[model samples]
Target: MYAIERFESRCKKAIESILKRSVELEVPPPEIGALFALPCHGLSKYPEELAGELASKLESLDIDLVGKIEARGAYVNFFPSGEFYEIVLREILQKGDDYGSGEKKDEVIVIDFSSPNVAKPMSVGHLRSTIIGQSLYNILTFLGYKCIGDNHLGDWGTQFGALLAAFELWGNEEELESDPIRHLFELYVKFHRESEKNERLEELAREKFRLLESGSEREKELWKRFVDLSLREFQRIYDLLGVKFDYVLGESFYYSRAKRLVQRALEQGIAKISKGVVVIPLEEFGLPPLVIQKSDETTLYSTRDLATIEYRLEEFSPSKMIYVVGAEQKLYFKQLFAAARKLGFNCNFVHVDFGLVTIGGEKMSTRRGKVVLLEDLLREAIAKAKQVIEERNPLLQNSDEIAKIVGIGAVIFNDLKGDRIQQVDFDLNRMLNFEGDSCPYVQYAYVRGRSILRTAGVTKVTLESVELLSDYEKKLIELLSFFPRIVKLAAETLKPHYIAQYLLDLAESFNSFYTHCRVIGSPNEATRLAIVSATTHVLKSGLSLLNIRAPEMM
Candidate 1:
């Protein structure tokens, strides 16, 4: 890759010199000040005539052909140069998998995502955070930075206490033995209905919540059981998506220091006790004053969040913290961030929220009993992929593995192929299609590129002796040449969708080049093979950033 880069830069410089020389020795007025576009076509009848024409124009104006000007009417025009492209390309290939980096201790990123609540199967809605967070993690790591992935699990408070009380009242050992989470969920639902009939039962649940908060041994054991079981269930889904976290630390993790946090905010006069609730003044920030604590003195999400921020600032000392949660919690994040800043923690705190995945014009909800499981979706996607595999290539050796990659990749890509803030209407058929802007289309393109390389065996893209004279060849070169830049942009913006779009564009360019040019049978075998190698490398690099696999077979 470094050699490839050096060659490109040298070529640019050489072309610019030739352009200036041609202009200095020009013979026509129509050739004054021509700037060459690498893959342009002829104007009059001759290729060198246009180059000569460009040289004349550049010479007349006394504008040098050194990046400032160039000449030609298409047909792979040439330009003058300094050695910038070569320097950049060499850096990329030499860096190998890590091309974007700096030396001054760039920054630290804390990404909080995939926070499914306790006692519920992970629904497809949770896929947004898990995949989006994973992609962000990949991009940040690609750049020269330290990143922290924290799964802020919902393992806290009254809900668990209610579920616990309900479990005890409707105790069933056999059901718990079979499937604890689902069985607990059923009791949870029933408890709400039953409590509506008996106020005394509701009181017992509140008392239990108090006991859990007060750190009673029995209550502690119950809460621990719920948390442990919930985590194990979440892990299964995470494993399916290839997602891991630096910290499984959750809301409960910060419970011990919560009281101290509230007390400090109170002592500093940053938070006040009013109406028996703790609050942060917000009239100056242009919103209604927020409740930082309830009258009961038990903590709220705001309290836990503010505490988490305080803890993170003290513990990890992060430079940037990203909360990859849903758009529905936009106000909550804004309030939380504002409050944290007010409390005098000036580090970068970002709340990267995405739009909802709705079904029939309503937000997907688990408590409402209208939800789809992520496992189910993955299973379905794979099943459909298995069918496609059979139809496309039945004798494939590892059908299951391939189907899993393609199917799961489709689901991950479907959620990520658009603006993260744009709402999605779930459509299974559209996601599975291999013909459009889907994962399969990109995978097929990579496979096709690989096939070209295989047939052109014994030769690869290098800084070998070859000329890039064809317009199609230049177009392909330019496309692959922009990978490092594109990847850098995506990483800086914390957006994987940009990288996804780039892959689609690269694949399109490959397809177009294939349609217009002869690769394997070309007269200049080295040049054709060079373009082939560059395309393969770029595709592999791009797919890896998006965390998608590039199978060498269609």
Candidate 2:
């Protein structure tokens, strides 16, 4: 906020002066040099081209400049004077972690994500939402938005009735105590198979379902027991994955509300009788009419979602609601949004859909049992990381700690490095590598920056009578200046991969700067120390945004 006010005042005065002079002198104002890059154009490095081209143009125009614009080949560059350095660096150092955190609007956002069903194991596919949603939460919260994480648990449906029938017939009292989800899984498998052979058992399940809907005391108690038991199992997996939801309200939670919601739709003429089922007449809106209520009177996901939508708006008054679900539900979300709009929802809605998380070109699902547990994948990554740490440095101290920082980081960062739309093949070999575009490599770059700073005994960063810094340092600083802008872009675009890629670029640039410039015992120790500190801060901030840990000692 302070930066905004300060920049506003300065920019206004500068532009006003330029305008006044332009009219007085009857000449156009000189173009401002704003971009920075390394020279790589016309056989020159990006930094050289940036400086030469802009410097020549401005000199020709006879405009007294405050800074130099240079380039190296394809890269354009900028170097501000000592005054600029003092102002920018002091602001960043003063703000610390709050350096880039602009006070964004106090908007409420309902993030419906990772809506895993009860008694279901979290697979690698779930890991996509787990990481994506968590990172999005961090980014939005960092931007000062009030975010509500909603876990729309799949707890109501025909599946529960089948599960109950199976539990009653083949339920073991002891295995439920040891492992409830697995026990339910077994019962569910058996009940599904036996439902075809026995009509009495099937009728009993149907009666129980009816009793559940009709709010019988025994049915309520049974449903509560099943939900509690399932939740007990779900929480363990959620805890392991570091996911916490503000609300874990299930599908059943809105059954009562759904009944009222459908009735209102009927009263409002949004619901119509079609094919003997209550349907929303949306044929004019490029889609067929949707069944709002079935002839049997059982509600669907769309019905519960409509109620959920109305409830969320009433409860949180969110400015935006984003659902991070699988791509297969694209049509479902479209219908929900359309129905909500048709029913007069004024809030902005978004569905963040992502491709499946597959391994070795095969779909991962529970039915096929081809799914990889997130825990198992993480453990394997950690194990491989441990091996890498040992092989790289036999005397590496605190191997377990380093392994974790790198291992878990690899899993998270690997997925984050690409756009969320990109389908990940979940290659273990690629994820665990210490070289070539891996998470550990980026962390190593940070450790290198820290190492350099430590060697220089960097107790303080002082602004010297600065001139045009060399290509590497100036280009690197230009990259550092991109942090705030990139943060804004990431939040606006609803894409964390933007920040991820920017961090990698900064790391790669820092490596080049390190190879070229020596900070410790240098004649220009202050300048180099400033660069090292900036690099370390940027890497730290970037890694933290992705929920990845950075090891100072690595």
How high is each candidate's TM-score? 0.83, 0.83
- lDDT tens per residue, model 1, 1-554: 33233334544555466554322122123133212334323234566566566555544443332344445443333333334333433444445445443333557778888888887788878888889998888777766578888888888877777887988889687887688788877787788778778988877887787788888899889678777888888887777777889988878888867778889988999888788888888877776666876666777767777778888888888998999998888877777878888889887888888989877768876545677778888889989999998899978888888898888888888888888999888777877777779988888888887888788674334544445445565555555655665666776777788888878887888888888878777776666665656666677777776767778775
Q: What is the lDDT of residue 484 in candidate 1?
A: 62
Candidate 2: give its CA RMSD in angstroms. Answer: 6.3
The digit string of per-residue lDDT tens for model 2 on 1-554 reads 43323433343343235334211111111132343222324433554544455445433332222255443344433334445545555556566566677676778999988787665566778878877887888788877889999989888766666666777778897997787767777676566567667877777776666667777886677668767887776676566445678998999999989989889999998888777788887766777677767676777668888889999999999999998887887877777888899999878999887887887998875544566777677878878888988998888899888887888889888888888887888787776777868788889998887777677676556555444467787667656766777787787887889888988888888988888887777776677777777677878887888888788775
Off by over 4 Å in 1: 1-106, 192-204, 458-460
TM-score of 1: 0.83
Q: RMSD of model 1, in Å?
A: 7.5
- lDDT of each structure? 0.72, 0.72
Candidate 2 Cα outliers beyond 4 Å, as residue runs: 1-87, 186-208, 216-222, 393-398, 454-468
Name the lDDT value of residue 467 in candidate 2: 41
Stretch of 10 with least lDDT, candidate 2: 21-30
